[model samples]
Target: MKRVYAKEDVCIGCRLCEIACVVEHSESKNAIRTYKTEVPRPVARNVVEERGPLTFSVNCRHCDEPLCVAVCIAGAMVKDEESGVVRHNEEKCVGCWSCVMICPYGVIKMKPAAKKVSKCDLCNGRTMPACVQACPNRAIVYEER
Candidate 1:
């Protein structure tokens, strides 16, 4: 399976990817309306990290040996055998936070109000993730190795 990777050297930390992520997953998929009408707004699955002179976006790596899946009590987290994407089944999630504790990348997050966990699913709706498409500087790309 192809995955999203970052070229930190070109990342401008503009957060376009973050914005695009929120909009992509937004209820209506509209940037302006989603912000104005949605209460508290949507939290992005992918996060941008910035240091003194460094910037990079991070999300679920869908690791070969994901500890998150092993500890998920609700069995909501699973790596798709065909795609190798670590998918979180929101309906099956028990909000146990077990995956949150076990993820070495610190990427998994809780949607407390929704009583579910959230992580990157690689945007199955499209060929590429919203973040990758939205990155103006091409700091991010989807590649298979």
Candidate 2:
């Protein structure tokens, strides 16, 4: 199964990954409308983190044994056996924050208004994740490794 991975050494901190993620998840799927007109804009599932001169994108690892899936009491977090993608079902979520607390990478985020948690779903339906495609430096890659 393929997963998204970050190449920290080559990352340039452009943050195009974040923007692409938001746009890809948006209802309009248009950058201009998603940023300028969309109300309650969709959040980026991936985040770019910086520490002084170092920067890299952070996202769910979709672990072989994801703790987030294990701790989700409402069974909202699930891992697809074939694809190895950890998916979050907002409708089934109970807003318990169990997944949030158990996520070791701190990638899962809580949606305060909806009382639901969100995480990287690998830009479902896309050939490649938005973040990996938007990365100008090829800092993010989707592959079996």
Among these predictions, the greatest lDDT belongs to 2
lDDT of 2 by residue, 55-109 (tens): 9999999999999989889988999998888989999999999888888888988
TM-score of 2: 0.96
Deviating ranges (above 4 Å) for candidate 1: none
**Ten contiguous residues with the weakest lDDT in model 1:** 38-47
Residue 43 CA displacement from its true place in model 2, Å: 0.8
Instruction: List CA RMSD, all candidates.
Output: 1.1, 0.9
lDDT of 2 at 46: 83
Model 1: what TM-score? 0.95
lDDT of 1 by residue, 28-141 (tens): 899999889987567788878889889999888999988998898888888898889988888899988888888887788778888788899888869889999999999999
